[model samples]
Target: MKKKSIVSMLVAFYLAFGVLFSSVSAKIQSEQAFDNKIVKRLKVNNIYNHIEALSKEPRVAGTEAEWKAVQYIKRQFDSYGYESELQPFTFIEYKAPTKVSVNVNGDTVAAAPFTYTPNGDVNGELDYIGLGTPDDIKGKDLTNKIALIKRGEITFGEKVINAANAGAKAVIIFNHLSGELNGTLGNVDNRFVPTIAMTKEQGDILVEKLNSGDVLSASITIAGSVIEEKTSHNVIAKKDVTHKQKDTNQVIVIGAHYDFVPTSPGANDDASGTAVTLELARVLAKVPTDTEIHFITFGAEELGLIGSNKYVDSLTDVEIDRIVGMFQLDMVGSKDAGELVMFTVDGEKNLVTDLSAAAGVRTGTPLTYGQEGRSDHVPFYYAGIPAALFIHSPTEPWYHTPEDSLDKISKEKLLETAKIVGSAAYQIARPDTPALERAKVAPKEVDYEKMTGGLK
Candidate 1:
C-alpha cells in the first residue's frame, strides 16, 4: 500500500476504537444510576431513633459501653438480614486525670492535669524554668525539682516532654494569659512526667518568690492517668444480590465511627453518623445491586482513626482495589452544625463525592467538597479507593463535649444528609441496567468556589 493510504487506514481504525469506547462507557454509567426507589426509604425518624438509642450513654473506645454500642450496631445490621461481623484491634488507650493538686509551702493551689501525662505524686523543691523549651533546660539542673514552666510559643505536649527530658521530677505549666490551662499531650507518651496546669497569677507569684532567693518546697499529685492495652472493633455488614455467583467483584463501603470522646454522648459527633449508616443499610439491603455494599461502624476514631485504619489494613491488595467507593458519615445531624460538606484527603473529587454531589443537587441539598484528613474516609482514600467524608461543618459548640446530646440533634439535618448520601450511594451501588437510567442521575460540574476550605 502507498504511505498515504496506510496513514488514512490507521486514522480510520483510531476513530472506530474511540467511538466503541465511548458507547460502552455511556452504557455502564446508565446502568450504575440504578433505581431511585431507595432514596425515599431513608427516613429521618428511623435515623433519629438509632441515634437516640446509641447515644443514650457515652461510647468511649474500649469501654464496656462502647462494646455494647458495637453489639447494638451489629444486631441492627443482622436485623436487615445482612451478614455482619465484629472486627477487633488493640491500641494503647490513654485517659486524663480525674484529680490534680498542687501544694506550695502548705497552701493549696488550683491545678488541672494534662491528658496522657503520667500519674505522679512528688515532693521537691520548686525551680522556675522559663518557657520549658529545650534551651531553657539545656544547662540548668531541673533534676529532683518541680519545674515551673510558662505556656506559649509551643504546644503543652512539647512543654511536658521537654521537662521530662530534662530530668524534672514533675512539670507545672501555667497559662500564658489569665485562665486555668487545659491541654493535652495529643497522644499517650511514656516519657511524660506528672504534668499539671495552673493560672498565670499563681505562676507569677512563684516566679517572684524564686527571684527573691526564696527556696520553695512544693508537692504535686495527679490521679487517674491510665495507660493500658484495650481492644476496639469495627462492625461490618454486607448486602448483595441473592445470587452470589453472578455478583461483581466491585464493592461499595459506607462507614461511620461509633465511638465518642470521654464523657460525651456523641449524639452529633458520631452517633449521628452511625445512625445514618444503619438507616442506609436498612434501606439498601433489599435493593437489587450487582455490587456488594458493606456497612461498617468503626471504633477508636477519636484515638486517631484506629478502627478504619485496621479495617483497611486487613484487606488484601485485590480487595482494596475492588472497592469501588467509600462514603464516610460523620457529624451529619447537628442542629447547630453548618450545611453538608464533603471532604477528600487530597482535595479532589472521586466517585463518592461526585455521585453524592449529583444526588444532592437532584433531591435534598447541594453537596460541596474540600480537603480534610480527620475521618474514617482517610483510610480508604489512602488505600487508593474513591472515598469522601459526609459531614456538617463549622461544627456545633457542643462538639467533643458532654453537651453533644440528643437535644442538639436536628431531624431536618439528619434527613437532609441522609437523603443526599443515600441517593448518592444508591446511584453507584445500584445494579447497572439500561432500564434503571434516569435524567436526574447525571453528574454535574461541582461549584468549586462554593466549596468549603477554599478547595485546597
Candidate 2:
C-alpha cells in the first residue's frame, strides 16, 4: 500500500508540470501569432514612400507646406478605409525682426530679438537688475531705463513683464551659457517690453561696467517684427472595436508630429514618426480588435505642442477616461542615432512602456526607458494617460537642420520601431486578451535600465 501511494504521487507531479509547460507554450504562441499579423503586413517601402513624399519640403506649422502635408495624411488614412477628420486650431505666429541692433556706450553689441517682441526703438540708461524678478526691482527706480538681466530663475517673458511693470522701457537678457541666446517670449503679451537676448560674455561685460559705476546709455532698435493669427490642423483616423459585443471600452492613441522647423526637411525629426503612424493605420485597418485606436498626426508641434494640447483639451471627461495608453513616435528612423529608448514625462514605468518593453523582448531587443518631455507624449501624460515617446537616443548629427532629409532615414530602424509599437498596441486591442484595468493588470515585470540624463 505504501509503494502504490508513492507511485500515485509521482504521476500527479508529472501531470501538473506538463500542464504548466503547455500553458506557457500556448501563451508564447499566441503572442507570436498576433505579432506576425502586424509584422507580415508592415511594408517598409510604404513607410519610406510616405516619408519621401512628406519630407520633400519643410512643413512649417501654419504654412502652406503644412496644410499640404495635413491633406496628404488625411487622404492616406481615407485610403485605408478609416474615416479621417481634420481638426484645426489657431495660433499666434511670430515673424522675427528684419533688423535688431543694440548700441551700448557708443559700441555695437550683438543682440537677437525674442519671438513676439514688438517693434521698438528706445534709448535709455541701462540698469543692472538681478534676474529681473519683481523682488529684484522692488525698491529700485527703473523708470524709462533699460533693464539688464541674466537668463535664469524665470522665463524670458516673465522677466520682461516684471521689468515692464516696474517702469522699465526695454529689457536685455543674457544667457548663462557661452552661446548666442535664441529664445521666445512664449506668446504675445501687452505687458512685454522690447526684449533682446545676448551672449553670456557680452552680458557679463555690461554687468561689470554697471557695477563699477559706469553709466551705460544703450539704444535698442527692433524693426519689422510681426505677429499674426494662423491656423494649423491635426489629422485623426479612428478604428473602432471590431466586435462591439466584446468591447473593452478602452482607447489607444498612436501619434506623431507632422510639422517641422523652417530649416529642416524633417524626414527624421518627425516625418519618420508620421510615416510610421500612417503605415500602422494602413496595416491595422482590417485587423480584428476589441478596443478603439486613434492614429493622429498633430500640427504646430514645432511650436510648443499646440496641436496635441488642443486635442487633449477637446476630449470630454468620458473620452479622457476611456483612453488607456498613448504611444508617441518622434525620430525613429535616423541612421546616425543610437539604440532605441523610450521616454515618459515623469520618467516612471506605465502601461505604454510596460507593454512595449515586453514586445521589445519578443521582437529580439529589450528597450531602455528614460525621462524626457520634449515630444507630443507630454500632453497625454499630463492628462493622466499612460504615454511614452519612442526615439533613438544620441540623436543624429542633423537634428533640426536642413541635413535632416529623407536620405538620412534608416529602414531598419523604422521597421524595428513599427513592430514594437504595433505589437504592443495590438496587445491591448486584441480581443483574445483580457480587458486591462489599470489597477488590476499587473504586467510581467522585466528588468530594464533607467536613463536619467536628457535625450542627447
Candidate 3:
C-alpha cells in the first residue's frame, strides 16, 4: 500500500511541472514571433543610406540646407506610402554682430558679443559690480555706466538685466574661467542692454583698476546684430490602427530632430535617429496594430527644442490624453560612445522605459536607464506624457562637432537601436497587448544608473 501511494504522488507532480514548462515556452515563442516581424524587416543598409544622404552637409536651422533636409525627409516618408505632412512654424533667428569693439582707458579689450545683443554704441564710466546680482548693485547709481560683472551665480542675461534696470547703458560679463565666454541671453528681451563677454584675465585687470579708485571710461560698439523671424518645419507621418475592431484608443510617438548645429554634419547627433525613425515607419507600415503611431522628425532642436515644443503645444487636450508613450532617438549610432541607455527627465521608470527595457532584454542586449533632459523628449514629458530619450551615454567626442560625420556611424548600433525601439513601440501597438496604463504592467526590472556624461 505504501509503494502504490508514493508512485501516484510522483506522477501527479510530474504532470504539473510539464504543464508549467509548456506554458512558459509558449509565452517566449509568442514574443519572439512578434519581435521577428520588426527585426526581420529592418534593413541596416536602408538606415545607413538614409544617414549618408542626410549628413552630407550641415543642416542648420532656418537655412536652405535645413529646408532641403526637410523636403528630403518628407519625400522619403511619401515613398514609404505614408501621407507625410510638413508642418511649418516660425522662430526668431539671431544674427551675430559683424563689428564688435570694446575700448577702455584708450586700450582695446578683446571681446565677443552675446547672441541677441542689440546693436549699440555708448561710452560710460566703468563701474565694478560683483556678479551683477541685484543685491551687488543695490542703492548704487550706474546711470550711463558700463557694469563690469563677473560670470558666476547667475546667467549673463540676468546680470545684464539687473544692470539695465539700474539705468546702466551697457554690460560687460567676464568669464570666471580662462576660455572665451560664448554665451547667449537665451531669447530676445526688451530690457536687455548691449552685452559683451570677455576672458577672466581681462576682467581681473578692470576690477583691480576700479578697486584702486582709478576713474575709467569705456566704449562699447556692436553693429549688424539682427533678430529676424525664420521658418522651419516638422515632418509628420501617422500610422492609424490596423485593426479598428480592436482599437485601444492609445497612441505612441517616435520622434527625432533632423536639424543639426551650424557646423556639424550630425550623422550621429541625430541623423542616425532620423534614419532609424524612417526605417521603423517603413517596417511597421503594414504591420497589424490596434494603436496609432506618429513618426516625426523635428527641426530647430539644436535651437532649444523649439520644433518639438511647437509640435506638442499644437496638440489638443484630447490628443494629449491619448498619448501613452514617446520614444525620442538621438545620437544612437556613435561608434565611439559608451553603451546604450535610456534617459528620462525625472529619473524614474515609466511606461516607455519599461517597454524598451524589456525589448532590449529580448533582443539580447539588456538596457539601463538614466536621468537626462536636453532632447526632443522633454516637451512630451512636460505635456504629461511618458517620454524617454534613447541614446548612447558618455557621448562620442565628436558630438556637435564637425567630426560628427558619416565615418563615425556604426551600422550595428543603428540596427540594435531600431530593433529595440521598433519592438517596444510595436509591443504597445500590437493587437495582443492590452491598453497601456501608466505603470500598470510592471516590466521585468532592469539595471538603472545615472548618466555618465553629457553630449559635448
Candidate 4:
C-alpha cells in the first residue's frame, strides 16, 4: 500500500509540471504576438518622421515654433484615432530685453538679457560686487555702477534683483568656471535689471584687470517684458477609461516632454520619447485592458516641469493614490546609448523599476536599474506614487543640441524600447485569462563585466 501511494504522488507531480509548462508557453505566445504588432507600428510610420520634423524647428515654450509643434502633436493623436486637447494654464513668462551689450574701457562686448530683467539703459563705473547680494552692495558707492557679480551664492535672478534695487545702473554676473553660463530670471516677475551672466573664465579675466585700478566702464540696454495673459496647454489621451477596480482612480501614466530648449530641434531630447508614447497609445487603445493608461505629452517640461506639476496637483488624494505608476520616457532613440536604466530620486528602488526589470526578463531584453528621477516622474513620486524615468544611461553627445536631429535617431533602439515597454505595460494592463502575476524571483542584478563582453 505504501509503494502504490508513492507512485501515485510522483505521477501527479509530473502531470502538474507538464500542464504548467504548457500554460506558460501558451501565454508567452500571446505576448509575443502583441510585441510583433507594437514593433511594426513603431517603424514604417510617421512617428520617426514626426520626430524629425519637430526637431527641425525649435519648440521652445511660448514661441511660435512651440505652437506649431503643438498643432503637429494634435494632428498625430487625430491620426491615431484618439481624442486630444491643448489644456492651457497660466505661467510667468520671463522675457529677455531686446539687446544687452557691455562696454569695458570703450571696447564693446556681446551680452544677452537675464530673463525678466527690468527695463533700463545706463552707463556707470564698474564695481565688482562679490556675488552681488544686497549686503555686499550696502555701503559701496554702487549707485550707478555695473556690479560684476560672481555666479555662486544665490539664484542668478536674486543677484540681478538685488543689484537693481540697490541702485546699480547695470549688472554683469560672470560664470565662476570655464563654460558660458546660460542664465534666466526663471519666470515672469516685475523685479529685474539689465543684467547678463558670463563664463567664469570671462568674469575672472575682467575682474583681474579691473582690480589693478584700471577705471572700467560699462553700459547696458534693458528691454524687460511680460505676457500679461499667456497660457500653454498639455495634451492627454486616455485608454481603458472604465477600469474594473474603480475604488480609487488608479492610473498608470506614460509621458515625455514635448518642448525643447532654444536653437536645438530637441529630437532625441524628447521627440523620441514623445513619438514612442504616441505609438503605445495607438496599439494599446485597440487592445482590451483593465488599468487606465494616460498617454500624455507635456509642454514646458524644459520650463521647470510645469506641465507635469500641474497634472499631479490637480489630482485629488483619492486620484493621486490611484496613480499606481508613472513612467517618463525621455531621450530614448539615440545610438551608442548605455544600458537602459530606471532611475529614482535617492537611488531607491520603486515599483516601476522592479516591474520593468521583470518584464525584460520575460521578453529577453536586458535593463539596468538605478534611482535617479529628474523628469516628469519626480512630482508623482513626491506624491507617494511609484515613478521612474526610462532612459538609456550616458545619453548620446547630441542630446539637447541641434545635432539631435532625425539622422541621430536609432531605429533599432526605438523598436526595442517600444517592445519592452509595450510588453511590460500589457502584462500589467491586459493579462491573460489567469492574469499575469509578478515573477516570484527577485530581479537578477545587472552584471556589467559580462555585459561589456570583456575587461577594458
Model 3 Cα shift for residue 261 (angstroms): 2.2
lDDT of 2 at 108: 95
The CA lDDT at 185 in model 2 is 90
Tens-place lDDT digits, model 2, residues 197-256: 999999999999889999999999999998899999999999989989988888899999
Model 2, runs deviating above 4 Å: 1-22, 139-141, 174-182, 198-216, 439-456
Residue range 1-456, candidate 3, lDDT tens digits: 899999999999998988877775565567767899999999999999999999989999999999999998999889988999999999999989999999998899999999989999999999999998989999989999999999999888899999999989999999999988999988899999999999999999999989999999999999998899999999999999989998878789999999999878999989999999999999999799999999999999999999999999999888898898999999999999999999999999887887788778778778999999999999999999999999998999998899999999999999999999998898889987777655323233322221101101
User: By summed lDDT, which 10 consecutive residues of candidate 3 come out lowest?
Assistant: 447-456
lDDT of 4 by residue, 94-131 (tens): 65455666777788776666666666777888889888
- Of the candidates numbered 1 and 3, which has the greater lDDT value? 3
Instruction: Provide the overall lDDT of each model, using Cα atoms, as 2-decimal numbers.
Output: 0.82, 0.90, 0.90, 0.73
Model 3, residue pairs in steric clash: none
Better candidate by TM-score, 1 or 3? 3
The regions of model 3 sitting more than 4 angstroms off are: 1-22, 129-141, 150-154, 175-181, 199-213, 439-456
What TM-score number comes out for model 3?
A: 0.85
lDDT (Cα, tens digit) per residue for candidate 1, span 85-111? 989999987767787888999999888
The 10-residue segment with the lowest total lDDT in model 4: 433-442
